[model samples]
Structure formats: structure tokens, C-alpha cells
Target: MPSSSPSAGFRSGLTASLPITLGYLPIAFSFGVAATRAGLGAAEAVFLSLVMYAGASQFLALALIGTGAPLAVSAVTLIAMNLRHVLYGPALLKQAGADARKKHAWAWAFGLTDEVFGTTLGVLARGQHRFSERFMFGIGLGAYASWVMGTALGAFAGGGALEGFPTLDAALGFMLPALFLALLLSVLRRAQLPLIAVAIGTTALVSWLVSPVAGIFSGMVAGAAIGMIRAPRATKGNTA
Candidate 1:
């Protein structure tokens, strides 16, 4: 189906978003339980999920809230962690209209969680162009709704629902790591694969000696520097 038709696009979007909805429910429910434990009211927890919309970052920020980590540190770390999306924008720069692009970019930046990015990238990789925005929006909206709903449900049930699902809860918590591993495996290009392995090893070493976050940032910077240094130079006539 051509992606240009609005109806077709909407369907494509909906289809693309299915994986995220499946994955987000339990995780979002866990977040809700955690937020309630942290003293946020039911409504407040839902509100945080709706407004912040970045699951892992929200969890990390909430975890650090009482640890005396300055708000600025949390904010900067979240921003830096999400900066990877800057790489996703150029590829999709063609699909969006001017105003829609701006709105999409802002929404995308705020909502750039693992599942959403993964779903969107998958949709694009399927050779669908015209429907990419609708597909992305569908995924984002589905995940967002699931997050809010899951949190609300969790808050309403309090501890009862959690008590009945211990093993499931543990599995849900591990989903993010599993998703990251899958993503890393998917993007294993020739040059990039070796660099990622080296970066991971270096980051592991630094994390044992220093802060995990700092180690991660340092490893990414080092890998990027190495990639640039080894990049092939363009011939003079190729510029035209």
C-alpha cells in the first residue's frame, strides 16, 4: 500500500505501533507502583507519565530525586542521554510538512524512548515513506496512552496487583535491557560493530572505577572520535 493516502497511513501507523503497546504496559504499570511508593498521588503519577513521556529517563530521575543529585544534574543527564535522536532527524527530514515537522520534532524529542524509536525505525526500514509520520505518531500516542493507563491502573490496585505477579514484574523490568541488546545487534555495521564492542569494554572498565554515567559519556565520545579519525576522505572530483 502506498503510504500517501491518509487512511492507509493511519493503518500503517497503527500497525507499526503494536509492538510498543505490548512492551510498555507492564513497565508503565511498574512505574506507577514505584511512583506511588515515592509518595506521588495517583493523578500525579499519571501526570508525570503523560508530561515527561520518557520512561527510562523518568525512572532514573525519580530514583535520584531523593539522593541529593541536583535537579540540574538530572536534567542535563536526561538531555544528554536523549541527544542520540539528533541522528534520527536527518533521515526523516523529508516526510514532514513545515509546521508538522516542527511539532513532530518537538514531540519526538520529548517522547524519544527506546520503544518508540525502535518502532519508528522499523517502520521506515520497511520502505514506507509517506506514512512514516502517521506511523510514528501512532506509536508515540499508543505508548503514551498505555503508560498513563497502566500507571492509573497500578495506582488504583495499589499493592494487590503487584503481589500476584512477582515473576512477571521481574521480566518486565528486564525488557529495557533486552530491547537495548536487540537494537545494538540490529545496527551492527562493519565499522560500527567493532567500535561499539570496544566502547562497551572501555565503558565497563571506567564504570568499575568511576561513575557509570560519566563512563558511558566518555566511551561514546571516544568511539565517535575514533570513527571520525578513520573516516575515508572524499576525492576532489566527488564534491560536484
Candidate 2:
């Protein structure tokens, strides 16, 4: 059953977020170093993580700014890339069922990055924990804090911080995706395989032909469309 005590829920959520926190540290560190190298100051790099808080999008923003893409274009591209995030709340809440409280959602929802959402959903889907807004808040807070901390350290460390550790630098780039993928596979079902495959293929194709940003957006659209079409069939099969 979902913990009714707010403190208990919060603590549990924080504990569960440990893995995400660890995963984010290196990646955020990488971003910080990259940012400074790209001409941003330590404070500026930290500000990006603090305010924007969009993992991949922040990197993309840095790229856009570095390349002298008009600020308007950069803004639009960032928004388009992260558009899929809009669906995360509804999907998570739906999985949480009617009993899941939303009174604190406005605050907690801000922390719902791809990894955080996947982690919470995995917990609920696996019956490891009942849905609690406080719990969600804890998870989000922990992950966010770690990310910011990592970014600060990296920024201060300067661009050459990882120069001696070439292998580590390369590995950091993969951590975000790898972490999310692990979370996803935890909740994977045979019925969802086709949707995942379609999304991956579309993303890869678009990215290869055009740009990574365009690919991500197209993949999201394709995945959502496929998911909606497949939902009914899955429901019917379950009922039958």
C-alpha cells in the first residue's frame, strides 16, 4: 500500500533515486566541462543546469549557442526536442491510478525528467512501492541535486578536467542514455517491443539523414502514434 505518512514516502523516494543520482553525476560533469570549453563560465554552465534542467536539451542548447544559431531558433529547437516530456505526467498518473494524489503534482512534476519518470513508473509497475506524491518529490529532488552538484564540480574543474581520462570522458556521454535504457528494459513487455523498435528505427534514420534534434522529435511523434494505435489492440487481447 502507498505510504500515507509523507516523511516515509519522501525518504523512500530519495532512496530509490540513488541509482539515477549516480548515473547523472558523470553526465552532468561532462556537460559542465563541455560548457566551459564552449566558452561559458562556471556560473553560466551551472545556471543552465539549474534553470533549464533538461539533460540532453541543455547540451543541445549549448551547441546551438556555440554555433551562433539565432536565440529564437535555439529556443524553438529545444522546445521541439523536449515536447515528448508533456506526456510523461499523464502517463505516470494513469499508471498510478485514481488513488494517486495530484495536489502536490505542480511542484513534483517539475522534476519529471525521462529518468525520473521511468524510475517512478518502474517502481509502481513492479508494485515495489505505492504511488505517493511526496515520494515522487523526493526522487526528483535527489536526482536534481546530484545533477546540479556534478555540474558545479565539473565547471570549476575547467574544460581540461577530463583530459587525462579520455576513456572516462567518452563513457560519460553514454551514461544518460544507458541509464534510461536500463530503466526502460526493467518495465519492458512483449507488447511494447514493436513500439520501441519503431521509435528507435525512426530516430536513427532521421538522425542519420538530417540532424540529431530532428531525429529525436520525429521519433517521439512516431512512437506516440504507434503507441496509441497499439493500445487498443493490447487491451482487446487482454480482455479476450
Candidate 3:
């Protein structure tokens, strides 16, 4: 039932991505604003977005360029920043069947970002939505379109736009984490509550004790291990 798509499946896909679309607009706008402030022309800003389409990395690259970093160093830094994105794909791949994992599906892998990954993971965890290419397309396309449009708007608005709406800036600041938490809560199930608590507790504790990076990676690894260990028990309980 969870994997089944009804008559309005495409619409469902689009609907599922609404939160992400909303979350993307201001941040992408911020990127455009940043690009311009970094001395990039509007054309260059839009072009950078179209070519790179990487959210944080785009900002970092622009900053690096502004600082007169060498091309190779800039490239390597941007690439390194994006390496964590590799962690997003395998989980999604396992959820996809061979046919669904066709070349076309893999081709759009570039669209996968932290926000999209979390939303998709949430959807999969809920086990109530079809994770088809069309669905994934909606998730990716909606976020992509919003991001590009927002960038264009920001480019046109320039830096003053963000300043004009101070609230927008604040909202954009918290968009990613807010969206991540919202997605997590939306997918939270009673059965998974304990594990989620463990993951959250561990992440918070580690982040407080160490660095944000250490906390993030440790939380992920620890949560995954716990989930795996509990799966067999869950299966046995279900069978009984």
C-alpha cells in the first residue's frame, strides 16, 4: 500500500515536495543576493546557479572566487564540501528497484541536496508514498525550479532586497534545519520513536561535547547501527 500510487500520483509527488519548495525560495534568493555582492553580474549569478546548482557549494565557490583563490583550490574545496552528498544516494538506491533505478533516475542525482535527501528519506521512512521516478522528479524539479527562480529574483532585487525584509533573512537562516526537523517529525512513527530519541539524544550530546561535524556523523552512524540491530527484533515481533 505504501508503494502504491493512486490516480493523482504526479500531483501527489508535487504535493509531497511543497515544503521543500517553500523552504528553498528564500535561501536560493539569498544565494543570488550573495553572488551579486561577491561582484558577480546578474548574468554570472544566474549562470553559476544553472551550471553548479549546488546550494552551499555555490555560495562557497563565489566566496572563494571573491577571495582570489586559485581555480584548482576553489574547485577542490567546492568538491570536498559536496562529498557528504554521496551519503544521500545509497539509501535512496536501495529503496528503488532495478527498473526504477534506471539511468535516467541516476542522471538526476545532482539534484539531490540535504533538504531533498531529508524529505525523501522521510517519505521513504513513512512507507506510505511511492518513490517512483516521477515522484522523485517532482521533488527534484520543484526544489530546482524554486531555487532558480529565487536566484533570479535575488539577482534582480540585489542586496537591498534581503535587508528590506529582515524577517525573510532570519527565516532563510533557519530554513534548512527547520525543514529537516519538520520532515523528521512528519515521518515519525510510534514504533520508531525510541530509536529516533536515541539518535537525537546522541546527536545533541555529541554536538555539545564535540563539534557539529562529529555530532552529525556520529549520530548518523549510531542511529543506523541501532536501526539495523532492531530490525530483526521488529521482524520477529511482526511474525509472531
Best by lDDT: 2
Q: TM-score of every model?
A: 0.75, 0.91, 0.79
Select the stronger candidate by TM-score from 1 and 3.
Answer: 3
lDDT of 3 by residue, 1-240 (tens): 664554455566677778988988888888888888888888888888887888877888887999999999999877766666766787777655452454565656767888887787777656657567666777788888888998999888886777877876897899878888897777665556656777788889998998654666677777766767786665222201
* Candidate 3 off by > 4 Å: 1-7, 96-100, 189-219, 225-231, 234-240
Number of clashing residue pairs, candidate 3: 0
Could you arrange the candidates by lDDT from highest to lowest?
Answer: 2, 3, 1
Clash pairs for candidate 2: none
User: Residue 238, candidate 2: how far off, in angstroms?
Assistant: 10
Candidates 1 and 2, the one with greater TM-score: 2
RMSD of each: 5.0, 2.6, 3.8
Where in model 2 is the C-alpha error above 4 Å? Answer: 1-4, 231-240
Per-residue lDDT, model 3, residue 84, is 62
lDDT of each: 0.64, 0.86, 0.75
Candidate order by TM-score, decreasing, is 2, 3, 1
lDDT of 1 by residue, 59-166 (tens): 776777746688888789877665555554553453233413444556545555666665565444344544345555666677777778887887766645677778
Predicted structure with the largest TM-score when compared to the true one: 2
Which residue ranges in model 1 land beyond 4 Å of their true spot?
67-104, 126-131, 223-240
Worst 10 residues of 2 by lDDT: 231-240
Indicate whether candidate 1 or candidate 3 has the larger lDDT: 3
Q: lDDT, candidate 3, residue 21?
A: 86
Worst 10 residues of 1 by lDDT: 231-240
Residue pairs with backbone overlap in model 1: 13-135
